[model samples]
Target: MAPALNVELAAEPRSAARSRRATTEWLASVCGYASSCDIGQDIVLAVNEAVSNGIEHAYADEDGVVTVCGRIEHTAPERRPDGAGPCGAFEVCIEVSDNGRWRPPAADPGHRGRGLMMAEAAVDHLALDKGESGTVVTLRRRLGCPVSAS
Candidate 1:
């Protein structure tokens, strides 16, 4: 089993790069042991998008903090009485959260606002939570599978 990663950084533009580097290193270390470097790369891309969004959109102009956490889990598929195929595997789960409320971006054709969409496309599962205090984005991708599966 790989060790979990948890990091807290300032909600600034520069922190996005820092978060990406840290996440990349951590994922590489974890996936290298499992011989799943491709999955790690995909995770880094998805994480970068989410972290960048948190810094650029969630905090905007105010001071805030972003928390990033990651872990690997093994899940067993639910058994069906009808004898369906089994689907159990290891997966990497990452969560990026910012302590600021979410605001919709203005409708500007020239402006690029597809980070979340890209993240959704890159990962197997993506979830977003927006509340009075903050927003959290969760990304998950299964390991030991082809990139298309993710």
Candidate 2:
């Protein structure tokens, strides 16, 4: 597969947009390489939402760092132990992490929240890890074919 895409940026409001653009470009490159752009768009939207949440909620007070990483995995179809058909397929994973504490979004209807919800709706799988140290959001989307040989 293509080398994992990585970016570290200041956890500022403006950085959210920058993160989105960088991720979009990387996804576009991967899609172009694979001749598949439809899925790339979905991945980009999900990643943007995750990054926005990191910048707005995770680092609400002081400056910190947000790390974005993208990777593609190609799994060859393999028979199941129960004599079932092959079950594995290709997938792309995107992770957006911030070295800042997590805070629940405001309850006000117009104040904040919704990024995670939007991200969840856009991706096949979504995972969230939160603790005193920081929060990490991972989004995964299944691909029809391998994007690269790696």
Candidate 3:
């Protein structure tokens, strides 16, 4: 089974930073040596943006909760072209959801509306689902890693 992180917190300004810290620490614990690379930082940044969007846009009328879930999965290793060995790879998936109504952006979004763009830039895949209940932002990235000997 892969390592995972599930955190639910109040939808507030501080929740973004809290999620960032939690994700950073969790990645370090599960990703091992690869956590120091740029992919780790990219994952954290994308997660932070998703959480911040939920807190800022989702709970405009009332109090609500935000949930951040993350997991790392090892994929099938591919043989290198040079026949050196198998090249290991892993995919990290993180979902940030909020239990609040989705609010349409203001007519004139000043220095805003860039959350999705920024998130897309940081990860390999980004998807947003908005429904009557709330909104969910998913970030996924696959990166190469050193293969561990069994």
Top candidate (TM-score): 3
Arranged by TM-score, best first? 3, 1, 2
- lDDT of candidate 2 at residue 10, scale 0 to 100: 85
| Reference-based TM-score of each model | 0.82, 0.81, 0.86
Number of backbone-clashing residue pairs for each candidate, in the order shown: 0, 2, 0
Please give the CA lDDT of all the candidate structures: 0.79, 0.77, 0.82
Better of 1 and 2 by TM-score: 1
Model 2 RMSD vs true structure: 4.4
User: Compared with the true structure, what per-residue lDDT tens digits does model 2 show for residues 73-98?
Assistant: 77666566686666446678888998
RMSD of model 1, in Å? 5.6
Q: The CA-based lDDT of model 1 is what? A: 0.79
Q: Candidate 3, which ten residues in sequence have the lowest lDDT sum?
A: 141-150
Error of 1 at 84 (Å): 20
The digit string of per-residue lDDT tens for model 3 on 23-71 reads: 9887777655535578788888899888988988888868999999987
**Cα RMSD to native, each candidate?**
5.6, 4.4, 2.8
Cα deviation of 128, candidate 2, in Å: 0.7
